[model samples]
Target: MASFEASVQLNATPQEMFDFLIDTENILKISPPDTGLSFTKKPDKLYKGAILEFQIQGFGKVQEGTHEIIVFEEPTLFTEKQISGPLKSYTHEHHIVPAGENQITLIDRLEFEPPGGLLGFLITESKLLDLFDEGFYQRHQTLKKLFP
Candidate 1:
């Protein structure tokens, strides 16, 4: 399994940050251009059984996936697992931690296994890492700007 985590402190309350993150539509606004991330389906509001279908551009192709919200706790934490996708397995956890008065820490934790074993490892360790690095950076920057 391969894992990646990133966190950013924002000048917003935990509730505020959590509300924004829970909305699937905000993803299109925050994702980096290189990711080419797009949603095929989204729910009116994220819930424990909500499923999100999205596509990512990679290796000159678009890899599509459906992520189900397995855990949902309002204004605090939520975890989603990929039910169908290019990967063998994928799970993501989003945490909203209180930093200070009117401040919060947003953390993204991702665990995944690629499909082709060794080749998948190589690709994930290289290209996928680069893609996520930029994606997370852009996401944080966009969040800060949006909530600051």
Candidate 2:
């Protein structure tokens, strides 16, 4: 299994940051070209049963996916699981906390294990891992501008 974590401070209220994140269309604007994301169903808002699809460059073909919004603690925490994707399993947890008056801290955590056993391990080391790290950095940079 591999894990990743990142946090960013947004000069917007928690609700504002949360709203921006829940917008699925934001993916198209912010996601890097390599993600190969294709919209399946857009959520009216973040909830327990929103489905999304994206093809990860290093992962195998067509990775149908869903976002199981497992945790919804209002303007604080939201979590989700990838029901189907290129990985054998994936879970992402997001946290939004008050950073100061008019500011918020966004935290993202991911835990996943790829398929193809050892071959998958090799692939991750060789390709996907670094890109995933960069993707998060890009996302944070984009969000800071939008929310600031």
Candidate 3:
């Protein structure tokens, strides 16, 4: 399995941060424009067992994926796993902790593997890490500005 973790401090309460993250619509607003991300199906509000289907334009083509919310603890933690996608397995956990009177710390932990065996491991360890690093950096920057 390959994994990456990142955290950002936001000038907002846990509830505020959680509320924003739970709204799936905000994903398109924050994702990279090149991703061409759009939701094929999404729940009005995310909850345990909710599944989200989305498409992304990448690798000279479009790819679709479905994310299922496996855990949802309001104002604290949210976890999701890819139910169907290019990946062999994918799991993401979002943790929100109170930092100050009104500040919050947001941490994202992700574990995933591609379809193939050794080649997938090499690709994930090499290329995918950089891709996710850049993506998460952009996401944190956007969250900082949005919450501030």
Give the best candidate by lDDT.
3
Please list the residue runs of candidate 3 whose C-alpha ends up more than 4 Å from where it truly belongs after superposition. 117-123
* Residue 77 local lDDT, model 1: 95
User: How many steric overlaps are in each model, in order?
Assistant: 0, 0, 0
**C-alpha TM-score for every candidate:** 0.91, 0.83, 0.93
Q: Which prediction has the highest TM-score against the true structure?
A: 3
Candidate 2 TM-score, C-alpha based: 0.83
lDDT of 2: 0.74
Can you tell me which runs of candidate 1 are displaced by over 4 Å?
117-122
lDDT per residue as tens, model 1, 53-128: 9999877789899999999898899999999988788899999999889998899999887678665765665566
Worst 10 residues of 1 by lDDT: 121-130
For residue 128, what is the lDDT in candidate 1? 63
Candidate 1 colliding pairs: none
Candidate 3 clashing pairs, residues 3+ apart or interchain: none
RMSD each, Å: 1.7, 2.4, 1.8
lDDT of each: 0.85, 0.74, 0.87
Summarize candidate 2's per-residue lDDT along 1-148 as a digit string, tens digits: 7887888988988887777777777767677666677776666577656565545444555556666777777777778888776667778888888989999889888887766677676566336557668988988888877876
